[model samples]
Target: MQEAKTILTKFNSPTRFEYIVRQASLESAEAILNLNLGGVYVDYEPRRFHVAGKQLARGVLGGVTVDNLGSSGLELQYEQELKGVVGIQRVELSADGSTIPTEAETIRKAVHGSDLILTIDRALQSQVELELSKTIQEAQAKGGIVIIQKPSTGEILAMASMVTTETGEIVSTSHNRAVTFSYEPASVLKAMTFASVINEGLGVGTSKRDIPDTVILEWENNEGNTETEIWRDEYEYETQEMSIEGILTHSSNTGTIVWAQELGQQKLYDYLRKFGFGQASGLEFPYESQGILHDLNKWDPSNLNTIALGHGISVTPIQLVSAYSAIANDGIFVAPRLVSHIVDPSGNMERLASTPSREVIAASTAHQVADLLTSVVENGTGEKASVNGYKIAAKTGTSWKYFAPEDSYEMPNGQRDPYLDINGQRHYTSTVTGFFPAQKPELSMVVIIDDPAPIEEQFYASHVAAPLFGEIAAWSLRHYQISPFKEVQLSDNNQQAFNGQTIQEGGE
Candidate 1:
């Protein structure tokens, strides 16, 4: 009825929609064949949803596309573009169910699925996956994710994830964590506040303030009761006057909150949403998370000062990267994309529309914030993330993993992890995100390490995520041949790239 059928063609549907159940359970099949009840035999249908066999990328590839051909989902990413119109056929069949080609004539030809030209670099994706897996093993942590993007074009070159399954297996996750997973982003979000403050002309990167050891956050709760929360630095510190750059470089929780209070609630919240928090990143991936952003009226004390310190708010890795990408792209927030374009059957390629982009901050403000972040890598908490000659603009974040359920974090298998913070919960997400060669940004990357070991030390973003960021960024710089700036200061631990080889000057 829909046409496009080949009348005499002896072929199956070319949609690639329903792949065969290649990895069926051998046990079930054997049982079915050997079934015997004395002189009588009976057979039963196997379980509807059980796949058994080795999968090359059981998790990684499982999350790809829609249906049995590769994955399982009704709404696959760009399914319409991928699933070409099916060609129809009308052919006579004998009693044996064989097609009678002699009695049939061609009606229409089936159109094969379109080829998706993705921005993801296969080699880079593999490298990222390897590094993420290695990091998970080395840290002895639960799992992690890494993403690499081009600032100017919003093209995602690579994204990889490994997660702890319900069965406690550390394997590549079936879902793209970059777009789906949301968590408190800690200090990596400080850039947003800084960008806003600078955009509002309230402060500059070098603007100095007398920071205190602690600040009391008092605000009305959802119940209309006045609530008070104390905001303290991760480490003990006396009252000190520090520059805005210093506050971010050191990632001072109290210092950030104190300044964020200046912007007021409405302004701060506005900027947060504008930066793409509490909203889906425009990447438009299937099942993309918008992250948790309460309405302005629904905000509590935590949403204010606490959020300024990168707490209380939830954000996806894609959102965080896109926000930073705006700064790297001269204040333009270009939504990330996986597929570059699509190619039709006739080899005619249909270029996709431009990625959603908007100017989040002025170019000058973004530059100022970028410079501040550069200081972070050069002489702040993100030192481990620095490349010797490349000025890096980045931030380190380590926040207590917020488990909504009291004293329990839910597992994938519908089980709750029965552990509290005091019981070696080790619930912490460490993250680092930045763009390199700060003067002229090229690449933006985000590294997230979930629950690194030794809570007292390795759980810190600097120790876990920063080093990984440096490793991957260093490799990318060399691979992409990105030139470095003048030799002003050389890194100590970061003096080398892949192996013991000294990292030469980028200009070299």
Candidate 2:
């Protein structure tokens, strides 16, 4: 028995042989023992834990069993390739249920699973998670998402999603808000509007509009009755002549509406589609939302103003970031990818095909829009996102949450009474998106804080999200050893000046 155990161990087979003696006939048991001692059988097992563990980008969960692959995230996305084929064996069994090894019939070897190499940088991913967790706690936000991507390659480097529990403890979630949650993008869409205006031969310098604090529209309802709707800016600005760059810098809703009106509804819709709004990002993420962009037939006078100001439309964080990547990539739109390639068991690699791309806007138009965004980071709403020595191109967004009628009002049951805040409750989604080394961007990122508290100086994107962006951007640059484009002077007030020159606006 000791010699048999030693032989089985040498053959990499199970060492226990008492079960065979109990279950098999005397002759079969002798045959099994002889086969084991001869070192003729071997078992190759598969792994249960593959890659980084649970909720790695919101994957489904199942028990750790050999047959149970992960249910969500990349696990589900590439399950076919990850789950290798099972091997099969056929043998003549004795009446006692033990195999007669000398009469073994046939066997088919297993094919090992292919390995997936993601574009994610594990170290950078950890850093992003740490910073995002801290920011969500400091702002007392309900949830948040941060995404870092390479503009030239459309490879997602890091994705972090964190949410606050009912107990007020912050934790990472499996919801993957960056690719799933859709909401009004607010002023972030203004950059797309400005880009469209520049692409149609309507020079940014030549395009000027007189904007009012409020716009009143009268239209006929479906019942043929006259309806009146009022659209107002967040704050009252003087009715003055403003250029496209000024509109983006100040984040003026009225200014954007005026330009959208001139650009026409169909043209604006086409440009928005081209920018990848209201569409899936093609990353093949499970349950990924395409967001909401009403068809042209659904358009009304209110939609014109609301959509222009990013009210009526909804967009996911991935979709928004991909569109910005196009601008950063000099107007070429490349679909974003998560998995870089797969390595088969044969030690050969199968690289994923390059995602299709097209020129959405002229390179010059993209550069002009990028320059306008630079002004925003330098002297406008995104000032908090500015790094010390990098020419950052960025935009800030603040949008109100939409409450459904059923949620706003209580039912006839013993529930809370229906009520609406006269000034609208102070709930906001604050966001900052940008690309650094503005002239030739390497990294583009977006940070979103959902429903931050109305605490003093904490509700706006500039105050909440922009600071987080600056921290992550600065750290990434230094970690990646990116050289600064210009000398920077940091004052005690935390303000940064670049080589004694503020980035000048287009048409200067």
Candidate 3:
């Protein structure tokens, strides 16, 4: 290629350069336009389109056919400083080009349009980001997300995401995992379960309150073994008898499933849909998963049983938080929000409001759920998640991962799908999502750790996920300028004991 000439120009002056828009060669220009170079004026001196001697004519310039794609920041939005001078220097084009100091400086300044204001507290975001980074790295987690939302108003205080860094490079393993990843929320859905069941009049009972150890269903398999599954209310500790409250407190999958079935599939589905289960949160992020909930018309015999207990359906973190907000806001569904307001260039404020959903449960039902959830933390599986001065309610879920062949096991008696938990042996998604100041809630959060390393006999949510919630919640409460309810410090022994309790209770 012949050496190109340099040409000095100004922004939006319609500098003379021509290329057919439909030409495939011009497609590269599209990419350049999309590439955000800090939205600054760049010095353009062509290396390929230059002509001989005193530079080609301006009308039919002999320089690179550069096009001013557009400007960003205040320049484009508020229509400020639409035009700027460009510096041109004749130089040989290398395989790769770099930004000139003056051009780079201009772009950098342009990127910040009169200091963009954010609803999120910078201090909180920074602290949460730092803590999340450490957790993601240390745990070798697949990915993790931390979100703090004001339960009263549905405002997101902070949102941070981090994943494992492979090859020692900080690679964003995935996009925003919170609102995007829609996996089985596991037992975290139990809070909804409890609310719906109680709304239907099933009073809270103990986990070991003599429900039915082994319900022998008529559905049998080839092995001739009766379709009987064992109902063991054992975590890592001694198999303890728990009431309906105890069952949720302990996150007994068996008990939860039983109650879910009693509440009826249709009722459960209605409550779930009301909670925005099979829908979107209406956020601005792209590719937000809507979550899966098989239509009720196609319900199977085990559908209600499984779903009642938080299986067979899927949800995103934002969806979960928004649903939980119903309880926090006294049964009224306040849509979760990120952007507080969008301002025009002329200082005009346009509020970006979150769409509100109708109240799903009665305000009384919401208070009941909040109270029960508080018990889950005060006297249940979520005990590890407690903050001394503040009242918090939460639940832990450990899901079993089902793959191909092993997913279906046919026995003469019953069909069994054996999976494990965070402990490498076998299990499903283990997670914990909850809110704090239970009586009068303020912040709501969810923590999902795909497969945590097993701490003791069981891979429990309280053992792994709850502490993470506690840490994040405490940090967030302080960061948001919310007065600390009280100081909470877990002794090494007490924390270990709580972890051990969770492990022992993992089998309910």
Please, what is the TM-score per model?
0.80, 0.81, 0.67
> Residue 76's C-alpha lDDT in candidate 3?
28
Model 3 misplaced regions, further than 4 Å: 1-118, 168-174, 204-209, 219-232, 235-242, 402-428, 455-459, 481-508
Q: For model 3, what is the alpha-carbon lDDT of residue 314? A: 78
Clashes of each: 13, 3, 36
* Model 2 C-alpha lDDT per residue in residues 397-422, reported as the tens digit of each score: 99887766555544457354323223
Compare the candidates by TM-score and give the number of the best one. 2
**Could you give the C-alpha RMSD of every candidate to the true structure, in order shown?**
10.2, 9.7, 13.9
The list of candidate 2 runs beyond 4 A from truth reads 1-47, 50-66, 90-106, 205-207, 409-426, 486-508
Taking all chains together, the TM-score of candidate 3 against the true structure is: 0.67
**What lDDT would candidate 3 get against the real structure?**
0.62
Winner on lDDT between 2 and 3 is 2
Which prediction has more favorable TM-score, 1 or 2?
2
**Candidate 2: pairs in clash:** 59-72, 59-73, 60-72
Residue 208, candidate 1: alpha-carbon lDDT:
85
